[model samples]
Target: MNIEELASILRNNYTNADKGNKVSAIHAFGVQYANEIKENNYLATEIIKKSGLNESYSTELSKGIKLYDYMKNMSTDVENDTEHELLSKLPWCEIAAIAMYKNDKNYKYTPTEVKNLPLVVLAKKIKKAESPSIGTELRECSNDMTTDYHRKTRNLFIRENDLYYLSENGIKYVEENFSYMISDDIDMPLNQILYGPPGTGKTYFLGKIKNQIMEYNKKVFAKKQSVKENIMDLSWSEIIALGMYKANKTNSYKPNELYKLEYIKEYIDDKKENGGATPECSLRSDLMRNSIKCDALSESGKTGNDYFEYEISKKVYKLSQNGIDMVENALSKYINPSDKKEINEDDFCKFITFHQSYSYEDFIIGIRPDTDYDGGLKFKEKRGIFKIICDDALNNPDYKYLITIDEINRGNISKIFGELITLIEANKRWGNEEQQKLTLPTGGTLCVPNNLYIVGTMNTADKSLALLDVALRRRFEFVPKYPVYDIDGIYYVDFLKKLNETILLKKKKADYLIGHAYFMDKKKQPKLQDILNKKVIPLLMEYFNGDKGCVAEILKAADANIVFKDTFHLEVI
Candidate 1:
């Protein structure tokens, strides 16, 4: 293909390649040399280079190296061998067996013996064999055999007991269509709303995203821990021990040492995005770190230590021992708060229900009176869930923060989100030039972090998409979740399909159609009679509004019957 054609193909299917390949391909296209590599050899060279192979070998032909010289010499060496002629007709698998035994790599096996080798063992050896030419050819054949044409028409089964062998075609399919794969390779949508009728697994899909984020978080933690251990001169654990030991001797800590520790804390914060630590702990840590930094800079005559001034009841105080003690006391409530009980994943995730009364203060930040240590309430600025998540995101840049709002349309969007409606935009988030920050009703400035992901579920049947707030709707990309009628082992798939057709015809809308989830039992198996009697009939009655004639006609079309009882409830007949 020409460079222009190739570039177009890549642009359309960039997500198909692995991450490194995708990046390299993009970089190659960006450079001036891309247009010169229109031939297959040069194109293959680019692909090979992107795949982490050496690029120099691609120019061997142009460098006066004869490709057929080595082959001709090898052909002459093996020309008199009778086995070569006999082995030519055999399949690659059998030929591979004969070659392995002939090479005699500390072990020997007859062709029959090698052919009968366990599939797992054979597959591993075939892929890892020292002879790349034989191994690569056999692997290609194995993968090509799994194609639908080969599997159905040729009825070819390279049986490996009950195990399904991975095919080259299968791998290619996953790599090409990776965005739709059931894998973590796909990027999570920044602002996605899964909308559908009730029981269509909208909320359940949110849980899936949460679980994916949780897994991603764990990986980020592990990677950060590894990098921290490998790169840091003094680790956090050792710093904590030294700090505590010094504190025990006297209230006064060394200035220079504290500055170094504070610098290290910044590194940790950058690595973690401040995720696992509580909001109050992060605040206290930041304040203390800043105080130390200020004192250090002041002594060096670079800057003044004026950053820590605070006033309470008209009395000004520096970021001193009193403030530190206050933070420690407040943090004590959350530290080992569960009396050494292990915290679970659920503790970190927040689920907020947005309603008409839900305000910006409630969602982001607020001011509430704090109870004094002795008595009475003190005016205190409180951090809300969003702020806490933002702090966490700031500390842990690699990890994602997910906020799932159920029934998002039930709330007054303009009122609840307020100024945040713009900040939530991908381009307006923190680190972007268009980023926004607002001083909360409490105190601190708040901005939505880039790592924070918002997943909301909306029941379109309850409120049509047209009724949603236009500003709120524009911020989120909606993904429709339709009912699955072709669930395996479900006998009512045809019945539900017919019923949904009737519903759309009668109700004049798709949202009111019955969802497949209603008929699914606890084990996720279909329960036909139970669904028909308890759920389907009752729902249909409400949809038709007790129009018995219309309901009866709908049921009759689906080869089912419903009867109106004395209690005015419809029952399966």
Candidate 2:
């Protein structure tokens, strides 16, 4: 077939295939038309352009052609070759890298080995096998693959003068056999403290985690029926039976009274706009499907009991005692924090900053006076923010609750956590075999739930981890959040890197190093002089304890002294 016919066929296949299978269809097209593409240098480009696919398809086509040529030249039975089997599964860039490696080294890799090898491993192998002065074109190709793949895989290869070379770990990785496939599992610590110098995007990282949770919830919501479909069919009694939809103060209500049809419709529409379950019947349905514990309900009272009982005469519904408990539990778990009255995203992924004044009562529980009572002031037991979150987390076993503590090291851990310090440990959390609970002064018991994750940020510039309470250190995993210098579109990256290097050399610690956040504005776009004058200089002053000479020395290392020409007057501390 001519180029136009092939392109049309490719376009049809691409359009018909699902999102995930589209790349494979493109590869298949290239494989089938490999000879034609090889003969005509511009055939792949022409076909890709005519196919009306994304620009990314051009790279995929090149990769597929290279892979096909390599397989056909290496194998007598090219159509049935094992290497051909991997063409669909592996990334286009990976296939191209393998082809390049085979061409340079004249060494054939088994399908098993090829399947097991990570992109970084192959890139490392290619770099090692090739000559030191490999031609500019080949080196550039290798560099492109390394740049594309290395960032996705791991930081193994270092680039120098547009050439890729393996680091110490990369060398070791290449020497190892491809016995096992690299795992795709990302390690998410249940209790992690991201400790770093200030402005290193610690809270920004927490925001990212919150966004991911929101996206996950959106996906879960997308698969279900539309809001109108779920709400439009439900009666006023059924909506009230869910217990989330309540009559406003303006609307009169008697005992066991069903809301008027107009009032119910208004409430449902308001819920759809603001929050709640958009009729709450959909939420009940979801709970019944995912969160309801049938066995637990059966054990609690009667077997084979539905969550709600309906009275035909009154046209009203009553929730079972066990069902009330189950619905309360499910509501906390399934409903987004934003859905609840007077609650927002902050209520879901709670954020709190710790300071010297922050106390155990403020964190867990405390006694406060109740002035609202009739006569004199009364002392009452009140749960703190942490305790409130813990209660919700305990109730909602299906959902994950996050409490992000900013400036964690500023507070006294022993004073703040009190006896509940041991409860935060992974093994000691509720539902674990070694789970432990502490009795409060108010006679209530408290345990940190398993579903609750505590992520804290500590500025090392204020206090180092070694100096933190041993009990706190032992219970939490510390993940270092250092300044990243290689951010795209950020000017003065080289200056920041040099400044950090000098700080490490002089201070003998990374704590005093400047963070990348300093160079960015509120919009996260890079800013230059204003940040240097206002934020960066002031921070340097604090680090050096107002010693202008030391601050000047560090800035000079980065050739940034020109910005602070008037500020540094060589005043020794």
Candidate 3:
């Protein structure tokens, strides 16, 4: 059963043991199981002595110690008394305090409400709190809370070993707001293709949802986290740095050289540049290589080996951006279709797949042959590297975790985002079956897990991204995020407003307007004049491109003029 179900059963069985008579009778039984982790009779005795109801079942509980198994065998009466007495001893106030940790952008928890709660109430409170991840101590203590409301509150938010979610609203919320694309059934390859129009938030949102689902695994692999998984997630600029390390070395060649290995490395490395490498992030800079695997033979209509030796032991393969995607698709096949289940066509996020070049580090290039380095010095993540991180954080009793991916669609669509399209769907994971692998262009394959999600992001304006093929577009779910009409924490609406007015005046339905993103200023707000004169005015002129009269007409509406004598204020570069 799921953690939520388990929490409910445990909570129900434990109620009413807090009262004087019930406590006296239940204390001993509670002590026996509580001390199982320690195997110390003295500790067990000490805890049991404090209980109003001492349990005689302690020895048997300590021997098996598996909560689910024990609960299955329990007569409702024994389980309830034992849990309530245990709740009486837990420090609810401390857990409440810890669960209330806060950060700059994410304030999902409040410190004030939890400070003075009674132990039993606090146990329930902590359980009900839904952070991205939670800890063992908190999970146990909350599980021990006997109040049905309190226990169910914790259960209302589901847990996947290291992840957390608002249980009741979890799936719906993710389908609507998360970045990864989710489906109810299995479809190979097309289940998700990051390079298409829906690539951005679709990839990212789905990835996050997968993380939350992962927590349900009963293994207890890692502790939980107290904060939102990507609260201080890297900005576009920071993301570029994560994947910008020298791929040539891993390609088994020296920089500025011409080995097939070096060729592939050079192609992948060229993705993060829009120009002279401006201080502004270069992630949205320029398209790196047409294919993740830079095989000259393929480029020249021939094909062969796609990888090389990395330093000594590891084999580094150069997957074309398309190659990378095929690999992900193959893996997704392993994840989604292994059970031979029927699926509907509408499961995919329909997209207009058009051809476009791509940059480095987007999800289109799922895996690359880069020098894997962990530890002191030697540069961390390269600019535009796409990697997913899975871990936990401390919320209550302990920490929770998250799995994250940045810029999901910057590479070649078909190559990079392979099998994830199928694996990410909710209904398609498996039915009493095992995992499989998706094949890549170079004959490589990848595997997907039920709890893993694929999330990615894209700027709709990029040139390379527009060229996705129809085959790939039919797989993912895309949620269009226009520039916000007004500024929130990230983007703004002033420029977007002025720009849209100008576009409408020229052609009402041209699908062109100032992006809601133009006015975004994390560091400071842009002045009205600065936006109009510098950023907007010139762009409007570019909109008309060569039509001087139409451009002049729109400028007058915004109260600005061309610089020529009869035009806008004049100045020649």
Rank order (by TM-score, best first): 2, 1, 3
- Candidate 2 off by > 4 Å: 1-56, 59-187, 217-343, 522-527, 562-573
CA lDDT scores, all candidates in order: 0.52, 0.59, 0.34
Residues 205-250 of candidate 2 have per-residue lDDT tens digits of 8776665444333322332212212332334433443433232212
Query: Which structure is stronger by lDDT: 1 or 2?
Result: 2
Tens digit of per-residue lDDT, candidate 1, span 96-206:
432332222223222222332332132334344332243233333342323322222211112222112333343433233221212333276778888888767787677
Per-residue lDDT of candidate 3, residues 1-573 (tens digit): 333433233333345333322322233233323334344433433333333224553432333233323332322233343433333333332233223321111222222122212222334533443321223323432322233223322232333332222334323322322111122222222133333221123443444344333322211221111111221232332222212212322232222232222222222322212111332232112112222333332444322222221222332232233433433453222112223222221121112222235432343233344443563443233322222221111111121222333344444555544454554443543221654545543344334434333344454444333454444455455545543453364333443456467667676642345554445566887665565556655655665665666665665555554455454442111
Q: Measured by C-alpha RMSD in angstroms, how accurate is candidate 3?
A: 26.5
Estimate TM-scores for all models. Answer: 0.50, 0.52, 0.33
TM-score of 2: 0.52
Clashing pairs in 2: none
Q: Best candidate per TM-score, number?
A: 2
Q: Where is model 3 more than 4 Å wrong at Cα?
A: 1-411, 415-436, 439-445, 462-467, 486-498, 505-507, 520-525, 538-549, 561-573
lDDT of 2: 0.59
Error of 1 at 293 (Å): 36
> How good is model 1 by TM-score?
0.50
Which of 1 and 3 is the better model by TM-score?
1
